[model samples]
Target: MAVMTMEQSTSRSILPAAFRTAGVDALAMIVAMVLAALAIYLFGNAAMQRVVTYAAIMLTAVLGLQIFSGNTGIVSFGHAAFVGLGAYATGILTMPAALQRTALRDLPQFLAGHEMSFFTALVVVLVLAMLVGLVTGIPLFRLSGSSASIATLALLIIVYTLLVAGREITRGSQPFYGVPREIGLWTAVGVAAMAIILARLFRETSFGLATRAAADDERGAAAVGVDHRVARLAAWVLGAVAAAAAGAMMAQFLGAFSPKDFYFDFGFTMLAMLIVGGMTSSLGAFAGVVVTVLVVEVVRRFEGGGVIFGLQMPVLFGLTQGVLAVAMILVIWRRPAGLFGDRELNLLRRPNAKMDPVKPATDVAPTRAAAGPISVDHLSRRYAGVVAVDDVTLSFEPDSITGIIGPNGAGKTTLLNMIAGDVMPSSGIVRIGAPVRQASAFRFARAGIARTFQNIRVFPRMTVLENVVVAARVVEPGLAAAEAAARRELARMGLERFADRPAASLAYGQRRRLEVARALALKPRFLLLDEPAAGMNAVETAELVSILAAVRSERRIGVILIEHDMRLVMNLCERIVVVDRGRVIADGAPAEVQNNPAVVAAYLGSRTARARQGNDVQ
Candidate 1:
């Protein structure tokens, strides 16, 4: 049994042992979900059920936020917009005929005349939320951090205003009552289940890995062929659907709703839960929901929505939100990572995981029967009028190791960036022979163009094994399966001994090796190592070479070695491409390239220096 060390920014996952079975955690999840459903079914009046349904709705909605904002380390304040759209869409489209006669009289012409079943309306609203995200994401796509946050707020305001001011369609800003409470307990549970499934699956997917990587360092992720925008957009749409589902469910629970329901207060509350629970884990979101909801329930039971603190007024109009606010502040001050950080919770109590041995990968020797060689045709990249790569063309044969070497400003990294599709070439095409079709950074890993960086970019807070597993996520099916595959990669890199150790805690050389392990997990056809030998001693560098050799032999994956350490490059590469100021100066075997005057000038400034370094190095 393989396992990652207990660490933040990662989880311990396992493959399905038999019949594609769920693990202890998954079974526990199933049991808990079933129990909650049963409790809602057996006990409780219509009102209690309504309360539970509301809680579930909030849980589902916040789960969406956690997926992108929490798990992926990006913040989005635009979630409420999604909820608002879903509610109005569902309300306007599915309002009961009897109530629609009076309530929707002033509604917009389009929705006023049209009505659909509650289920149909629900699905439609979810889709509508996605459409809204897609339509609006164009402007907000390139943003991150504070700028992205402000844009999200803008999105929220725009949607809120549209719902409120569009009187003809929304009954705008006015209270929308007489909405038949048709959302049943079972239905809400089903939706919550769906939300959990989606969140769980995505978090466990390769897309989720890329999302996290991109969040940690955009440039590094792009160099590895992960598209920054597309991954984020997918997260946005998924979040929108979940938010819409929550809103639609809320409308059914309330039996009526208004524009104010989709206000900043709601956003704040969800954000609070997201923060208090732990920003990047699904468990954190759900944990926050549990804590927040419990606080509210207790407060309402005692203070009746207000807390008794000496002579002052109640803590909250309703204790649920007010106490939750206090808790949020307290939690943020103390434990900012939230409940589990990036770790996932399983059924069994966790273990001392760092020392665990490795498990088996899906395939012993991952063969790329499809993709042939990767070719770069006259690739050029320019940034702000500066040519980063100029008319550089290179080819990486399948099952062969090649090296790209140059001085700091010679455009070695730029050329790799262009090949990976991180920086779209100014003029030229990157073609992959055989099964690989076209060149896209996002599809590179699956197409066999996985890579590592000079500056380590593994999931820092995650365990060493988790870092490896994260890389294979794109190639495998789910978290469990990916973990199984990653174990093999980690073992190959001689990192199984520290599988559970935090990547951040590893020495610099260890982190570098983990980076290589991660790239290997991708089952890539072509692997690029960008200064993998940097900051390593002779022993570490030799270890890296051994790992590289093993990778080529085991997986038959092509490799692009980018390094300043000429010794390592000469020792590992079959063909070497030397670039000087973004143009290839020499291309041939290591010894031949070393003898080139141009290569020598670029690396050592002249032939004499090369001879000196060669003697010293030998």
Candidate 2:
């Protein structure tokens, strides 16, 4: 009934989204900059810079884990190993020992004993980590949920073994000297900034959401065309590169190092730091590193000789680590997601709820074009030899409102998954218009198709605006594009008012609206909505119906609605498809499909009720 009130619809070529420029993000970044400046001003000398640089490197590593673990909802035990990869690679290329020895035998002898610059060494470390990531990532990326976590642990073991066994290359765990101590405050800060920016962009993208969704529910994400393998690989390779960067920074700071520096001790050290620092926000990584490092240093300085309960005690450092670790464990058990979780801080709320409406956009990527028609032909999907959908054929015609209704065990979801390319078919073609054999999840999305889940998958730690912006993740690959696109989508969904609120805080109806808005931002030729009206009050359902109708008519984009709300279905669907047990039972206009005895009996459980409704209406 309501036509977006005024002009909530966004401009086709919008600038950046309001969420990308959120007042909070600017304030937080500014705070970081200010704090960095303050630290430099107070110390401003080599002594202090050397000390802070190591702390910064550790924090950067923890931040990388936070991205791979905290926001994406997958725990990585091998991040430290990636750091080792960087350190060892750097040591081999730049250290005097490496220059003196013709190790790696296969590598050119000229390269050995040839002193490489810090910049070159840094580049080599990152590249080596990336290459290793590409190979190791394949197996980890193929796994789903908790299983993938176990695989990463295996990866850590493999990496550790390689480093320790390669005596010739790594000097048999001995100290590799002549590794330049060239790291400084400015270098650490620059790398940290880059790492944080990359992480922020990943978190704000669809790839980030898909990672979480897979962790939360793999099948659900795949149904929306989110390829788990590719998403995981992107996270792994990037996270590995980050780890290498952190390791290089650490090596530069220490100036002398060995393979043992990157073993379990280092891994545990980084893990504790990440856990205490809040593991979900980039800011948390910084906080955790500073706090943990200070705590450990202060305790070690005292040598366990502290007064507890007015009694002098020994082994204070031991007590300090134990207490710190326990505190972190408790925080996690009680508030599993950590202080900030995956959300960026907001600083411009002005202390009034009303002023919240004027908050800025906070997206890293956004789409620029509207979608066209989406077509799926002979699409099918299978799981472990069982065909969920077999050679199914359908199309969401451009600019039409279509509905698909089915029972619990029907193949409606399976078909949707194939179109989205979340699940590759045993054999079939799926394309918006062209004939194709198969496509990647990102590719499917890029080809102009977007969808929502049936169970309402929201990123719990993210704000409403963040959720939308992150969905626009795949649409815009960089910071500026994502920012513009997320803003335009937020306004369209009427969620501009609730932009900064955490997703878990929103009412059920609002969450549904945000999910739809995220899909719309993809600017798909067709939108597949799975149960948009599920579990809604009458008022809420009515609101949703209006919103959907307006979108279909105004956007000129076809929609495939998968819902159980009979009233909403009858009212909105121009044509309906009914299915049961992995196959379509009937297809026709709502009235005709409603009258079909088989459809009523199979899905609604009553033809008599349908007859009664028809009679009453007449």
Q: Which candidate is the best by TM-score?
A: 1
Whole-model lDDT values for every prediction:
0.74, 0.70
Model 1 per-residue lDDT tens digits across residues 1-618? 233233211433434321122134444554576687688679857667767777778888998897778645768888987887787777778777767878777654566645587888887887788887788776787887788888899989988888888876777778877666788777877888777767766764557767877777676665455676878888888888899889888876776778888888889888988888887876777778777877777667656433345554543455566777888888877887776666666433233554466554434555563477888878888888788888977777888899988877878887886676556678888886543234466666656677887668777766676566656666665666666677777777777778666677888888888888787777777888899989999998898888788767767778898887878888889999988878998999988987898776666574566688899999
Best by lDDT: 1
lDDT of 1: 0.74
Kindly provide the TM-score of model 1 when superposed on the true structure, using C-alpha atoms.
Answer: 0.79
Across 40-106, the per-residue lDDT of candidate 2 in tens digits comes to: 7586776556556767687678877877876556778889899988877776677665445543444
Error of 1 at 273 (Å): 1.6
Q: Give the poorly placed runs of model 1, Cα more than 4 Å off.
A: 1-53, 107-124, 127-147, 182-190, 223-225, 297-326, 348-400, 406-408, 424-440, 443-446, 461-484, 497-502, 523-525, 553-558, 575-618
Off by over 4 Å in 2: 1-51, 96-108, 117-120, 177-202, 205-228, 302-324, 348-396, 406-444, 473-485, 580-583, 597-618
> In the order shown, what is each candidate's alpha-carbon RMSD?
6.7, 6.7
User: What's the distance in Å from true for residue 526, model 1?
Assistant: 3.4
